[model samples]
Target: MEWKLLATVFASVFIAEMADKTQLVTMLFAADRDVSRWTVFLGAAAALVLTSAIGVAAGAVLSEVINPRIMSLLAGSGFIVIGAWVLWQAIHGGA
Candidate 1:
């Protein structure tokens, strides 16, 4: 395996996940639950793994059907939209 490629993927995924909605969902579920912390953590980790698998499969399929540049553009645009929505909610105070 190429170490450089692995490192780049690790860094990109880490950055993308750090501020993503999955973290928010994990926090919300953990806080609202009466279960043990370890139980919640394990459950959340399992769910994250499953979701990541689905994302990887989707990305693989997309790569086969679309150009890499277009796929990157779409992904970047989606992130931008989510970021803008989050910012708007912060500014307006959601109901």
Candidate 2:
């Protein structure tokens, strides 16, 4: 197994998720009087795990059918496009 790769992914995702909406939603859930904090944590963790699993599985399948270089370019372009859209929306007060 690639320990370094695992660590890199974990760190990258952990940092990225620090201020993510999912974390904020989990916090909001935990703050409710009727909701248990541990339950919220567990539910959020499970959801993240499941989503991550799906991403990994999809990536594995894609890797088999697509060239990694092309995949990387596509992914990068997707992020750039999304970022630009968000920026445009923010500038236009479109939210």
Candidate 3:
């Protein structure tokens, strides 16, 4: 295993997940008095693992068909377009 690649991916994902909806939802679950903290941790961790697995599988299959450069461009463009749309909505008061 490439330690550098592992560290890069781990750091990227850790930062990206910070304060995201998943974290928020996990917090909510943990806040509930009746729920076990262990259950919340396990459930949230399993869900994240499952989603990451899906992403890796999808990327593996897509790489067989699409060039990595094109994929990166498309992903970056998609994020830009999404950000712009959200900004436009905010400026327009969602009207």
Candidate 4:
């Protein structure tokens, strides 16, 4: 196991997930008086695990055909585009 890689991924994902929509949604679900907190936790955990699995599988496949550097560039550009779009929408009162 690549300990360093594992730690890096854990840190990155942990920081990114904190206070994000997924966490907020999970909190809302747990807040419902009828819902068991364990149930909410399990559901949220399963969803995150499934999505992470998909991401790992996709990355594995893509790394075979696409250069990592190019992928990084593309991801950076995508984030920039998304950030700009969100800023534009916010400035426009989210129409």
Residues 1-95, model 1: lDDT tens digits: 99999899889878978968988877887787676778888998898789889989998998999998999899899999998999999899962
> Candidate 3 versus the native: TM-score?
0.92
**How many pairs of residues collide in model 2?**
0
Pick by TM-score: 3 or 4, better one? 3
Candidate 3 lDDT over residue span 1-95, tens digit each: 99999999999999999999999999999999999999999999999999999999999999999999999999999999999999999999993
Q: Against the hidden true structure, what lDDT does model 3 obtain?
A: 0.97
Query: What Cα-based lDDT does every candidate model obtain?
Result: 0.87, 0.94, 0.97, 0.97
Q: List the residue pairs that clash in candidate 4.
A: none
Candidate numbers sorted by lDDT from highest down = 3, 4, 2, 1
For model 4, residues 37-60, the per-residue Cα lDDT tens digits are: 999999999999999999999999
- TM-score of model number 2: 0.87
Clashes of 4: 0
* Candidate 4, superposed: residue stretches over 4 Å from native: none
Candidate 2: where is the Cα deviation over 4 Å? Answer: none
Candidates in order, TM-scores: namely 0.64, 0.87, 0.92, 0.87
